[model samples]
Target: MNDHWENMARQGSRFFGKMTASLSHEIKNALAIINEKAGLLEDFTLMAEQGRGMDPKRLKSLAGDIMKQIQRADGLVKRLNRFAHSADEWVRTVELEEALALILSIAHRPASMREAVLEAEPASTPLQVTTKPFLLENMIWACIEFFLSENQKRIRLIPEKTSDGVRIRFVGDLPLPESSGLLFPGEAEKVLLRALGAELRMKPATGEMVLHLPKGP
Candidate 1:
């Protein structure tokens, strides 16, 4: 393969790795919850077997918990499908809301695991943006994965507007100490964003990581 193709493949692999790691972490948490629920059910069953009195309400609650877990597992599977096939390379004028929804949906599991919220607010209208959908999604994914991993349960994303563009800000409660030097995407992600006339700025102060996308182009 040519060098260009090789580089593309490598970038794809890296992006996939970031996503898969987050997904695996999500699946693990889901399984753990399922296990705990099952154990609770087993305990209840043993109690009934020993002729212990059981509240009808308690049994109903246990069933409800199991159903909730089933739904959680299903949601994760659907998200995995959306993310695994995100990059199609066909340029499209994607709706910001829909695009952000997909990004947040896939990112939900990992973000929630850390006790943080991934909040996205698009412009009031369709807010169409021209770019490779997959690449943009991957860029946001990279930011979320990095923050969540480095400072587990410490990140939150908020959308804001700049004079010339839109900004996705990531705020953390316990920001990484100033003395600790962290290498955020910096030049590479910036180069890609710049080509699309977008920009990203990571500020450890106030625990903010911002992505600036030009409103016009």
Candidate 2:
């Protein structure tokens, strides 16, 4: 089980690293376009100053578009940075709401691309817990990603009371029979979760998935 946890961590690092790299590449392209557009605007302004006719409004519009893309690139870089630091600690108390929010934010792109909405309940109280924050975060992330990749219509994180602690119910459209094995494809993720003392229950027949975690100290 410890091996599973370690494997999960490695897999998660690789996965998120790839994602960040891709986002960085996209941001770089956006910056290149912005640079080009700015240069064009500068040249157009220079030509206009020389009495050569130029549409100021058109130039303004192009510059505005460039600004929009620059803003987008900035946002992507921030998100990438946040996801990259998700595994900063081995064990600690993390606010459940904040953690969940981060997971949702990180997953927004793929979730939106797949047309899947994540329905979260309104919990006024923070669900704090002391555990392997990185592993727990990855487990939740994996579950959500699994749902999206399998083409599930939606996913929900419903909290419920459990004898030992809290049970997070992940209810979504049933995944294909063949897709079950894909839930924890690598030993890394599984071992990590096991080391953190987590429980996973998948019941396709009941259209239910559960992650049971203990309350924080």
Candidate 3:
């Protein structure tokens, strides 16, 4: 186990370092393009081409739009990169709220594409537990994907600290079929639950699926 963990750590570290360097260069190139465009706009205003000056208000609006896109892109890259580095540690205590937040970030684009809304209420207190971060993320993603397939357009994630560990309640807008378990917690999900020392329960009447995890995986 020690050797395996070290190997994973070394590989993940190298992967993250290389990706960060590459993305830094990419962002630099992007910013260079934006700067050139802005400079051209300024020159147009200065030359007042054809005796018509560029509108300062329009220029400011365009710049604001560009900045917003840049900020959004930066945020997405950070969340995904942090998630990718999750394997750097084989096992550790993780804050459940933070984990759900990252998973939601990853699922946001897909949910949007499907015209679905995903929301998560911040837990009042941290729900911390020891687990395999990457697998936990995988399970959460699977849950999100599974629940999204239902007719309900809005899916909510509620995090709670269980007496023995942590629980994340995935609630749906419509009442779920009691046989929902027949569709989810399938063979693969069961494997994940087993490995994580977790349990998945269906609450049909309440329209929710609860994932119960122990203090350690």
* Best candidate, lDDT: 3
**Candidate 1 residue pairs that clash:** none
Cα deviation of 17, candidate 3, in Å: 19
Find the candidate with the highest TM-score and give its number. Answer: 3
Candidate 1, backbone clash total: 0
- Flag regions of model 3 displaced more than 4 Å: 1-51
Separately for all candidates shown, the number of backbone clashes (residues 3 or more apart, or on different chains) is 0, 7, 0
TM-score of each: 0.64, 0.74, 0.78
**Model 3 whole-model lDDT (C-alpha atoms):** 0.77
Better of 1 and 3 by lDDT: 3
lDDT by residue for model 3 (1-217), tens: 5654554455445434543554555567557766776786777767785687677887887788678657855875786578777878979889888888887766765677688899999887967989988778878877887877876688999998878988999998888888898998765667667668899999988889999999987
Between prediction 2 and prediction 3, the one with superior TM-score is: 3
* TM value for model 2: 0.74
- The runs of at least 3 residues in candidate 2 whose Cα sits more than 4 Å from the true structure, single-residue gaps closed, are 1-9, 53-60, 112-121, 159-164, 174-186
TM for candidate 3 is 0.78
